[model samples]
Target: MAFKENYDSGETELKSKTSQDSPIHCSIDEDHPCDDGLPPIDGGRHAWLFLLASAMLEALVWGYAFSFGIFQKYYSTHEPFQGSNNIAAIGTCAMVGIAYLIAPLPIIGMILLPQIARWVSTIGVILMCVSLALSSFSTSVTHLILSQGIGFGVGGSLAYTPSILFMSEWFVKRKGLAFGVVWSGSGLSGVLFPLAIEWLLDRYGVPTTLRISSVGLFLLSIPFLYFHRPRIPVSHAVVQRRLNFRFLYSKVFLIYQIGNTVQALGFFLPTIYLPTYASQMGVNELLSSLTVILFNVTSVFGSIIIGFLSDRYHVTTCLLITTAGSVISVFFIWGFSSNLWSLYVFCIVYGLLAGGYSSTWSSIAHEVQHANPATDFSVIFPFMETGRGIGNVVSGPLSEALLKADGWQSHAWGTYGSRYGTIVLWTGITALIGGIAVMARYLKCV
Candidate 1:
């Protein structure tokens, strides 16, 4: 008789190994004889200090990310470079590189432990500050790409990673609440920074605006760097030898991996195009910029509320609610709307829902991992971020293609007519797909 393989034993073992929710990861949390990885989040002096400092750091880096729409509007409409939406988007693409692109390295570093990652990331701040200062002098996109995109992207990712690492370590039971506060910094930035940049751009021009932002980013980096300590006791020297491929073969993680891939394609299109759409509506460019600010402001409150609710209620349902809100807001309200008020209404509703989904990443990721899922998070979050990055890039060219076909930019709504409705229609479909995946994949819970 031919020798039989051990496939049946492995299949039975793998299913038993996964968490109660779904078969996403071969969770060692069940039998791994070890200390629970996270540290206490007692409101100690150090914790509060680090939290406040972290909040400021988040405010600067993410503020820039959220307010890119304001910059997009200015660049698209202003002289010397009255460019199309695609060209203007390159700057924000730099921001995307930091968030979606650089997600992995730091997670790897965070996994190794605190000391090495923390000190290494501190050096990242200097690199970012210098890039901002250098980019201020740049006139060409290549220069911005080099100084802002490459240098700042590298630095910002380093700085931002620790904030995430620390959140997992410090706040366990209250992780959702703490995460809501930390992530809400972007919404705060979205609210205030864009409006401020508009004034600075009008008064000082793009170059000057960049210089000012760099100085502020650099200053904010200091206090946070001083206080960010890791509470988790991770061993850097141990070579966690796991030759078994059992954990890699899970159904739940596979589904989320697939879900994240589809969702990423159209996520940022609204933040990127809202101002352009406003301009198309014959709204003043300055007021158009305010649309982003308003959305972000609304997001600040929305994130906190949603995050709190997720802890009490079902996270998957919360995700569905947000996804459904985004689809309806985009396809029906944003797609058909012509005037400023209708579009603005859509933006506010969308912003609130959008904020809910964005801030919940940490909680959902952690909860899915449940009491102990270090490995699951290590595996999944990067894939989700990768999906988001691809989604952002895809949307840019997509907007360009639709605009070329429709000549919507030159039509009555100006740039808005050419692209806004198209973006809403496309992104809504993708978000709906995300909702379907969420419903089907997590339906047992619902």
Candidate 2:
């Protein structure tokens, strides 16, 4: 069987292959026979163990970043960092933003240097520990940003991008569910880590919390790297093809990218501001933290369900479902809340819908790859993440600006005061606009 690339259409088609030939084989595996054979694609003892380890890695890297809400609350109220305007929020956003922003570098490296690509995750683990340890010595927010935000982001991108590529090789028919399971690790850790971090922050202070977390991450992550190995033996004989830029011109890619960016702009605001918003409502610290916990816990179920849906349904349909639910929750539940229960309800609904939206990336990747097999999963995945990173990076500044708009205050309206009214409105509007991709699909523009 031979593969042919249609440059004009940006699609790759297999030429003269029998009906029994599988298109799902890795490009590398297609060129070279496997002498030391591996387990089947979707299921096997080794394959499941690899998935478990990947999930653990996901928990350790992304879980810490997602739980930054606890740290944000601490930094805002505690000494030394207290009264700083949006500094804590900036740090958290920077960490997550940079992780998404730099995602493409590892993929490029994997393509250019397959031998060295295998070691990237190990290097990431060491860098993460070192960055955390260095962060413990920070005397100011700037220092924290440099050490925790920038350092963790770089380390995490290096560590996590490999898993994205590896996952493509591991699962075929159930790829969406596999990604959901892997991603739910962050949600699972998000549920538990907030309370634990809150306890540490209360008892030990910022420096001690940083030091302890660094050590714990090192211990939890090092063992997992061993299991993060590739299933397909990479073949050096296959000449490294020049990066395909045709996807950049595709209508479908642009439509999905736009929706992804719009959704991300508002998706992170709730997690970043929920604790502070609850505090303004006179909620206690532990309970305020509980909102985030609830969001993350419910998000676990949301990701899996959405992933299953993506596998069976069109990606556009899944996007519409998520966008509608998120927009409704923000407008109806969060926007009108007067007490803790309403906020809790908003958390559950938003987490269930918006939280799993990223899980749809697997389906989106499939859509892209189905069109252009020459485009590697590494490249396609990172491009989508980069779109979200734009929203993530801008969201910090955008959120601060919205919160500062006192003129939007409505005295008669509940939770529509100067503090949160603009934010709630902004979140809902962006979520609604994020469904533009679905509209584009209906219009046949994509």
Candidate 3:
């Protein structure tokens, strides 16, 4: 392929090989244009703008989902939805589960119908915003599940999938850092959104809060979507590669995926149950919400730092660090928490470790790519998400079962003596099992 330079913009365009020419544009530095005439790989103004927009969009979409604990708390205590069985399913299983489960579909669609990628995302934003508005009129839990849960989940996957594809194209060397920044957007929102949602729910009630949030999300999402687009020009003539499944057979990929699934199985427990647990301990609503705030705040920094390290270290090594920290926090700090201060400490430590785990997906992708150069890194991410999604879908019913069981009672002080003792023990066990890849690394299986 030959490059055509446009003097007006100082960008080099890649000429299409097909009969219908589609030019791919990239900024070329005047003094130091590379021999390939392609845009800078790791850093550029356009790249940064794309990253910023993607991150903000991620924050807006995920921020609300992560703050579902507040809603869970509110629903448990109030109104027609109050005392509803399996309320956790509304957030964890139905909404987030469906989101993760269907994540690959849009990515596949983008690959097969590249021209419609942006349109899909645009439609997604509208669907997501409208779902919230629709949910405001819910008179039953099933209505909330259909609208807020399934509808919102579908929209989010469509809107966000493009960013995932473009992100891989934008940054090669610092892919981990880029993903970290984008993923941290959720953590950043996690910090503020919980407080904001709690305040809104308390003052305005559920119906008004949902309607207001719907309007706010639609307005905020438009500008960001404008920047979130394909790095490569997409047209009908661009020959799409056949989807490959060879990487699924790779030992390294399997090990990492197993750990990912195991980790996710228990990772969300604290987020879903911590506020309720605190309330059960006689803490006020504001203080209970504070636990979620601390968790999210620490996770923001954790995602960035973990991502930065993954760029420099082995992916398994990074997993080991997160696993160790998560295990310690769940077993020691959270297990013994008798008051606000201890629970607060647990959230900070656990959030910093566990919340940042997904940022390492870039490292996992790079690892898979290194092992199988023909593999599409973009394709690998959604499968990893699928692994986590399996856990997300199962966690609600699983936690409910554990809570209802009669055994595992303890006389010890703190959470060990509480009904959540089994949950605490299981969380720690899963965190430890999540480090299975590290064992595989030492055994030379990876």
Candidate 4:
């Protein structure tokens, strides 16, 4: 009923009969689809190019955020920022947390100023370069926070939001696979950037390293803006479509959001601390960094696999796979680890499982759109990202508290006596709770 009303009012033409009794209605005509004079959907030269550029942009924007563990370790031991409490995690979280938090702004802009949607991404790229360049001059941890944290975060969100909005236009049938490929950019970059950053920090020091990265990012991003343009034109009338809020009232969305939020609370803990943990086990710096590399490399394949799964299976089913695998890895592999080899195993397993969960957003977005086509991917994704961002915002303080807790120190269970017990247990518990989203389907709440 809602879909029919929304479609009838919009620019789309309907092909099927609109009977009140029909449970399923085709909102758009397949025979005479709304013609915006664009390339074909799902597969086309422009579509593939756009997906490629988007994936690269994803790498450039999120790669640094994903590799923050290396920076965290570097800052904690280096001069200037050394001995600063939680300063490392603060910068890392700021960049990632703010990026997720501000996702809604670009979507809102698309609604209010549809004509400018194309340029928003360009502006975001400029902001990201400027932020990184400005960060090169930092003499204190606070400066890094302002530049790399807030500046990069804002820039990344600006650049990334448009991609999410445009994706639905390009690939309706294979949206999940498209999203997976785009998301894999981060995993690919995650594998490479950690090694590169570590080498740069070792040879060039922080200021030079930051400046070099700034220039490199600028060079890498500018060319891709050409390919990231929207496939369909957003007319004034299209922008005027009434925003759908029905999904918010659905029990399914509420349950999924809660689980996603809880999972996020501990999702970043291992990423932030894995290298340091490996070092504590007497592993060399290069080897410590290798842990992150392995995690990210495995995640690249994992994202593609999970994305394919999401396309075929229910979102809740995919969530269960990630949740169960992540919980098992954290509790069994990471918890009882007494050596670097065990930590390496944990990284690979966790990366393959938890790292792919973000790809499931495509499925969730599809589900929401099916219920209300008036609601675009932009609407659903920003809300889900906001949930994850909340968890990232608090993870630094939460991790510190968990690591310092004396109660968990004396326990003989797993790695409880190694000062990392609380963090391990917390990651496992949160992951388990995140699986509660699956219950929604079973209870017929969806």
Candidate 5:
């Protein structure tokens, strides 16, 4: 009855008729069938080129935020903002956190005013660059928070949301892989930027590094706009379908989002704390930075692999795979790590598992869209990202509290003996809770 009702509404639907069935079916956009003379859905020169540009833009936009651990390390020890409490909040909560939180706004705007998508993206880039430039002039932590944290977060949200919208239009069958390729850019840059930022911070200090970064990103991001057009013509989108929120009440989305939010709570903990943790362990600064690099490098591959697998498997299967690996890395590898070898192992293992978590979102969208065909990916995707943002905003302060909490330390050896032990346990527990969706799946709640 529901599918017939959705079919009458001229909305797209997956070939599979039921939610219990695997979503590995042809996604038919009944509103714009193949005879419509539009560009091909999955594979075309324009599509691949667009995907490449999106990936590169993803790297440029998110790379800096991903590499904020280096900035966090620098701010804790350097002049001006040194000895300031909650320095971690600038990167985790203000920049990345706020971006994820407010991302739905620009996306909502784009849905309403599809014609201005390119201009919005351009404005977002300019805002991000300007934010970085303003951050260079900061003399206090508050200034950095406003400029780098809030300003860049707002700008990045504007610039990035259009890609997600256009991307949904560009590739359907291979949407998971498309998202994987695009998201890998963040991890790819994560590999390169940490070393580069560390070098610049050491050589020219924070102001010069921030200024140079702002200029470099502006030049790099501008060219990608050429490839960022929507696969569907905007004139067709002018119909302005009513926004749907029925899927929000579904058990399937709720279960997956609970897992997603819980996972995000601990997802950023390692990236935010790893460099400083290594430096405190008597590792050289270069080696300390290398930890972030290794983590990001594995994530690049992890995203691609998980994306590929998601296309062929169920979303819960993919979620469980990533979750199991992540929990193991946190509990066994990171918890006992007292040396570079074990720490490096944790970064690689954890990055591969958890870094690929976001890539599974496309599949989640697919599943949710199946249940509520009238709801578009544009609606579901932003809400999913907002869920993650909830965790990201809380993680910075939560991590700080865990680090400062007393009675967790012991007169022993390894990570359990150190002040970081509580942090490690918290990370593991949250990661474990993040897998709760699998149980819900087994229980037939969906």
Candidate 6:
């Protein structure tokens, strides 16, 4: 591990000379262009390009997951293997669930077995890619359960964690914007993939679409693989220490972690259920699904705006404001939405809040991990990604239970007339919980 240097001792001073960063990070060396101690890159056109690429990669990875709701609708009804969301979730949950469980595996390897962890981790990625391609031909639930649950989930983990780690390492001052831009991939995917996948699914059957999408996911990793490199290398010395849960025990960190996990329990439910909820509310299928698009579109701006805020405002304050706003927007706007128009309003608002939720992950990570904004963020970034992966996996099952109240063909949640209302309620509660985390930090109540 690098020795901890105080902010003043000219070590950090070297930061400003190289990049708009602290001495801890120099981003411009030939061998490690991202980490070689270059000066910080200001947020501008070059920065925006980085954002765009990050968004594209994210759209492919995170967006695909968000769009699974669209596929979920198709899977639930039209097959020789027709099933409920709960039933179908075995594959989805396993993919996501295993993704979470394996996160610290490599980190742990770094501590226990340095030499083989790197190559073995890459092999895991190979296995993950194979998992999806195999899912296309499955005829039974077990096929998907094994193929997607184990293969794709683990594969995505290996691929995604590295990209995020690289991005954090590469951009310091602009980390929020960079993360925000990449973070928007989830939003962008929500916008683009659903429409694309829906068309492909309708034109080709699920089996064919899965095959194509698997190939697409495989191909999609190339750009990230080629362009994304770690700014700073993880040192063998750094790996000598055991996995520390000290951060997990920190007041602010715990608040953020648990709150985020709880929020995620429902944060994505809206994206997954909005289209179905719309159809149940008597909206047309085409229009119903478009809500996902509209919601994602609005989220793009929200992410950019929040990225701006996170850099300009205090991270805790920015998180508090966004979380509070999200609670209000989801609870009142999405909670009571009754018609297509109401949902439309809800989508834009909710989309923006959703975007904010993601943009903060990196910025807050920097603060909590105490890494310089411009230095290699590789040290801290993966932990947050792990936190989020856990959040994503848990959100699925909890939301599936709430979403079921409306049923596939009906709008009522058992006796209640609001499926979306129930969905919104879940997010609102979780969001408020996240807000409490921020507030606890500010007030030192934690």
lDDT scores of the candidates, listed in order: 0.65, 0.81, 0.83, 0.81, 0.84, 0.63
Q: Give the alpha carbon lDDT tens digit for every residue of 321-362 in model 5.
A: 999999899988888888988999999998898889999999
On residues 188-212, what C-alpha lDDT tens digit does candidate 1 reach at each position?
Answer: 8777788788889989998889898
User: Looking at model 5, how many pairs of residues clash?
Assistant: 0
Q: lDDT ranking from best to worst?
A: 5, 3, 4, 2, 1, 6
* Candidate 1 vs. true structure, TM-score: 0.81
Better of 3 and 5 by TM-score: 5
| Stretches of candidate 5 exceeding 4 Å from the true structure | 1-33, 235-242
Best by TM-score: 5
Which lDDT value does model 1 have at 97? 46
Candidate 6: tens digits of C-alpha lDDT, residues 35-128? 2343334444444454455566556655666666677677766775586336435434666656654666554554355444334435544666
- Please provide TM-scores, in order, for all candidate models, with all chains considered together: 0.81, 0.91, 0.90, 0.91, 0.92, 0.79
User: Which digits, one per residue and each the tens of the lDDT, describe model 3 over residues 233-317?
Assistant: 5444333432566888998898888888888888988998999999887877889999999998899988999999999999988
Residue clash pairs of candidate 2:
none
On residues 1-446, what C-alpha lDDT tens digit does candidate 4 reach at each position? 99888977663432333322111122222233334456777788999999999999999888878888888898889898888776745544688888887787788787678779888888988898889889888878788888988899999889888888788677777888889998889999998899999999999988888888888988888889899987766555444343456777776677878888888889988888889988887878899998889888888888988999998899989999999999999999999987888888999999999989888988887676676666656678778888788878777678888877857675665575678898999999999988887777788776
As for lDDT, the candidate ahead, 1 or 3, is 3
Instruction: Tell me which of candidates 1 and 6 scores higher on lDDT.
Output: 1
Worst 10 residues of 4 by lDDT: 19-28
